[model samples]
Target chain A: MKIVVCMKPVPSSEARINIASDGRSIDPTDVEMVANPYDEYAVEEALRIKEARGEGEVIVLTVAAEAARSEIRKCLAMGVDRGVIVQDPALLGGDGIGTARVLAAVIRELEPELVLCGKLSIDVESDVVGIALAEYLDWPHVSLATKIEWPDGKMAKVQREIEGGAEIVEVSLPAVVTAEKGLNEPRYASLKGIMAAKRKPIEAVTPSVDAGQVGAAGAGVEIVAMNPPPARGGGKKFEGEIEEVVPQVVELLKSEAKIL
Target chain B: MAGRVLVFAEQRDGQCRKSVFEALGLAAQLGDEVHALLVGDAVASQAAELGAHGAQTVHTVEDERLARYWNEGYAAALAAAIDTVQPDLVLLIATVMGKDLLARVAARRNLAALTDCITLTENEGTFEAVKSMYGGKIFATIRAKRTPAIASLRPSAYPVPERQEAQPTVQALAVDLPAEQRARVVEVRKKEEGQIDVQEAEVIVSGGRGIKDPKNFEMIAGLAQVFGAAVGASRAAVDAGWIDHSHQVGQTGKTVSPKLYVAVGISGAIQHLAGMRTSQCILAINKDPDAPIFSIADYGIVGDLFKVVPALVAEVKKVQA
Candidate 1:
């Protein structure tokens, strides 16, 4: 029961986003990068599955730069067996398809029985790489999974969130599942685990990818410009007794907002 | 490059969704020929309505294997439609199903796809789009270098065109499906009827940490009921188990941009604001005058939500009556 969890470091949710002078990328200065919030659930779910089985290995895989080693180490501190970081400048800022191709190549070498990833990264919010990776590997993918169980390690029963409710899905082994929020409460790294993580092996390797087929060069989509959304103006506050203010709000809703 | 566009007109339970028409409306503007592809068990009859909405050609892939959305089967169907239509652009409404299918098909063909775009424009057969990043904190205008680039337009971002009498050629596309599906849906559990999805609602009334108790959501629901709007909750309320995640609106939950969004007791964390700052009109009702929610709100009421919500509901009912 080998499981691989895919995670990425993204700008923290609380960080203010400022477009760089290039007008195509965010300003990275003064921004804290952390594991994508959803990826924490992916890591936690993998750990739970491994603990339940009691005789298998879990690996954390990431295609990030050198700065992401700390985030990968955080996953190891939470009890993953080891980590693999694909350090390649060509892989950075590639479109989802290109990134998925790189991940699929690495996943083929590992040959894990199951692969898990967060539903989407907080930075790009594409929600494409995981599903695309599964497609590239020719495996079944269940996105937005809230619950998963594989009693016999052959067939997996997953519960995924849909628009209105839930869908119960079943896929064979060697499948990909994207963890949604509420899948599990991720555990913080203990002092002992942090000490253990430092000794755990982290294999850094550059993938054998075509130089012309990655990064911004090989990306099919080109970003033309980046800008902040228009500022929201007019903060008309009405403060008074509820009886007097309620009508005023309704009057404006009908007349000014014209939304009624 | 051909000035033809293909849109995946997503349908559920034998009826087409309004969001598909919105995609079609945008498609009509971008391409000289607009083709609608509807895939389901028996959805050919709906092609007439899609034609009325502005599709010059309606492509239907009716198969029992596609009764439910099997990603592989639907992707194959879409790929076959793309092969036959030979359009320069592909558009879909960015629903959960749409986003999923688009990724799978794009990966299969190694095509370029942009998802959840808010705006799209064309220049000499090249299509460029603007999409949000970091949950709408910044906007990026992008262009795909490949022909027949795919993009999923966010629902409610484009308008649904008015119905007109037009006849479109209905073509039946044939697709090859795998003998055995790798994944299958065993069951679907849907929420109770009359509960609108916040993404589709025109008006939304949201509650946050200030609501205090789960039962207090009834007041929020009351105001929503008065105007037949959907009820939304902030991450704080959802995290506290006050509501289901489906009703949540924030960076972690669903992002929405309805016509009118009313926040009650929500202090407007940066994440919450990221999800809703693009809304057309916003109204915030919070006890704190300095709440971040007020900064983006068009109308603010500085008072306790417990008192303001009920009175506001009563006044709305009176005004509508």
Candidate 2:
């Protein structure tokens, strides 16, 4: 079996995100960047599936700038058999649909049996990439997968998280599954894995797909601006008996906040 | 004239989710004639309630596939409706299903899509949307360049207005679904029985890594019980295996803004802050006085959660009694 994992580098969750001077975008400089947290689940799930099968190639693909080499290397160290970096300036600033187009082209070239991605990237929080990728490739897609069991070479039983509950789904192979965190415990790169990763081949190529066909450009979705959240105003705490606090809180909600 | 605003009044089991009414209230702000598209089997019965919330017309798409949330099928239906109505703005509740389907519709139609918007306004013929970024710590305002702007509004962000009799007209549309596009949903396995969904809760009591152990969650649950709140966990608590990921509240977990949020033993990392910063009241209980959580907390108790939570829970019980 062949599996492909799509990964991206995003700012570490702990980093303080500041709006740029233009007040429409995040300040990228001086912030620590790491593999998107959810992508770690994807990489780990792919590695786990290969280990369980005892015979498979786990290929990790990333479409990022040259600066993301170190981040890609981390996936290699973790047990990915190989890597592919689709590097291009034109690919920059495209949204999920654009990213999916590039990924579909890569998947077609590789012809993998399975594809995996993080449910959503931290920066964009647009959980569209996997769904759009599946649509583009004409494959069955499941988002927020918590558990997966392969019953046969052609089909897999999967569980996906939904509002208030989860749904158990059966999807045929050659499908796409987006990994939520906790789907699997991602293993850190071991010493042996790190040394072996150095020998792993990483192919860097330009996306064969047209830039116009990818992202919001093709899908007709465009981001007009990104700004900081409004500052929370000072609030008074009512410390006393519950009788005192509950009504006070409710009063605050009705009067000042107008939320009730 | 600005096109009539469109709201996708998402329903399950024949009842409209509270977020639908909230979206309707928001739609009223955009225009006087609010058109709602409801897709489900046997959902037309709820049209009058939708009208009460300001829907002038209810476009009902009834199909068996719509009953169980067929993403591709529903996207096709919504796209077909968008083509026919040509509304200037489209609104959907940023629920799990809404988030999943809107992207596909937006992608297929090549329309600008925004998700999890907390606030919205129209200025000079352009609709601007504000979304929480970095979890909920930062807010980013976005504007779409295309007509029929598509956006998913966050739950609990907007208030559901009182019902008024508008007597909305209902229209039924037929959507042809292809067999290949329908992904089979074998079964819906709900999370552990009795566990409340944090996203739908009005009051949330969350525990963090500071709780020390899984058993400590009982105290948080006790407080939750007193306030009729849902129990939540920080990523650290979830990572530590003290609770399920469903209870996680943070940037990587669930983004929630309950009416009241109580954080116990949490250090207030920016990621965690992003999830609950929008809550109306934030109360933090931690031993460390310098915990970042206090920076945003409306009420801070610089004490051990083990000691403070039980007392808080007891006090809440006393208050409710």
Candidate 3:
């Protein structure tokens, strides 16, 4: 069995974002880029499947303007067999559908039996590329899966988290599954694995220019402006006995929030 | 004449979600003919309701597999339906299912899609939307420069419109599940039976690391029960193994914007704020006066949660009674 996991680097949640003067994109020079937290779960789940089967290979794949070396290395350090980066300058600021076209092209070449990705990247948070990739490749896809069981190499059963509960689903091999946070505990790279990852080979592939092949030329969505959400205004604190304070809170709820 | 707009009606237990109604309302404004696609077992029962919300025609796809949201089946059904409707815009509620399904259909046809649109408008048949990023810290204005675009309307961003008295033409849409969908659902385990989903709750009482243990979450639940509110937790609490991931609210968890949100023992991390900042009114109860949660809270009570929670619960009970 061959398993492939898709991952991306996004702005760290803790870092303050600075939108560039272009009014369309963010300035990246001062910001810290971390592996999208959700994709870490994808990498972790792939490693677990490989360990359990004890034979198949686990590979990580990414598409970005420049090769995301650190993010790819992070997955390799966590025990992926190899890494693939489809680097192209045109991929920058591309829409999710175009990106999916390129990724689906690369994955088709690999012809993996199963593919996985994070439910959504922390930056775009579109939840588009994963599902779009599955559709572009013409495969069964499941999103936000918390638990997966491969009853047989040809079949898979997964428990996906919906609005309130779990939906148990079964799909055939050559499927795409998106990882949510509860899927598994992503392990840190051990010293030995980190040392080994330094020598791991990173393969770079250029995207095909067949119009619909890479589809970078057909970015359907364009960013028009960038701004911050209006401030909510600093709040006020209450003081007094519990009885008095409760009434005040209720009055504020009725007057301020108007929910009471 | 304006182009046709297809609104995908999302339902659970045969009832439509508020966001679905909002999508229908928005679709009515954007197009001359507003069509609703109701896909699931017994979903046709909602045809009249969809019509009341501005749908001129309702396309019903009934299947047991469609009961729970599976992408392969829904995408195929939608792609088949689109061939007949040929909509200028396909609008869906930005729920977990809606976001996933629309993207798949869009990709199938090599079309453009913008998901979770907080602000959406169509000009000369072009679709432009605004979506917040970086945990709601920044906003991006995205435009889809094509006809027949796909977009998901964010929940709580738009309001449901008044209902009409007339009924719509409800037509049956047959689904074709492809061979690739060998995945099957064995069971659907509802963890919090009879409890309202936190996403749709008007009031939310959330706990954080300060809750200490899973057993201690009982207090938080007790307060939530008093007001018939849903329970939420910060990512830290979920990471500490105190609650299920479904209860988490933050960048890694579900985003919620209830009428009133009570944050207990939570120091507002930006990631956590990203999920709940849009709540109409926030109340923070924490031991640390400097907690970031207090910054956004409309009302704050600086004290120990163990003591404050029980006291607040009792007071709420008295007021409601």
Each model: TM-score of chain B? 0.97, 0.95, 0.94
Per-residue lDDT tens digits of candidate 2, residues B237-293? 998899889899999998888888988999988889888887877877777877888
Off by over 4 Å in 2: A213-226, A233-260, B192-194
lDDT of 1 at A239: 82
A1-260: candidate 2 lDDT, tens digit per residue? 89999999999998988878776677898999999988999999999889988999999999888888888889999999999988776765677777887888888989998999998889877667888888788787777888988878578788888877888877877888899877989898999989988899889877688867654455444555675565775346444554345555545544665543
User: Candidate 1, after superposition: displacement of residue B305 in Å?
Assistant: 0.8
- Tens-place lDDT digits, model 1, residues B1-321: 348999998987788989899999998898888999999999999999999999999999998878877878888899999999888888988888998898888788767788899998888777888888887788788888887788999998988899999998999987888777888888888988888889989999999999899998899989899879999999999988888878889888888899899999999998899899988899999999889898999999999899898898889888888
Candidate 1, residue A62: lDDT = 90
Best TM-score among the predictions, by candidate number: 1
TM-score of 3: 0.96
What clash pairs does model 3 have?
A168-B185, A170-B183, A170-B184, A171-B182, A171-B183, B268-B293
Which has the greatest DockQ? 1
TM-score of chain B of 1: 0.97
Count clashing residue pairs per candidate. 0, 12, 6
Residue-wise lDDT of candidate 1 within A1-260, one digit each (tens)? 89999989999888899999988888999999989988889999999988987878899999988999999999999999999999877777788878888888888899999999999898877768899999988999988998998856789899888877788888987899999887887999999999999999989867777756667777878777888976887579988988998899889999998988
Give the winner by lDDT. Answer: 1
lDDT of 1 at B142: 81
Which stretches in model 3 have alpha-carbon errors above 4 Å? A212-216, A239-243, B63-67, B174-180
Provide the lowest-lDDT 10-residue window in model 1 chain B.
Answer: B105-114
Q: Which is superior by lDDT, 1 or 3? A: 1
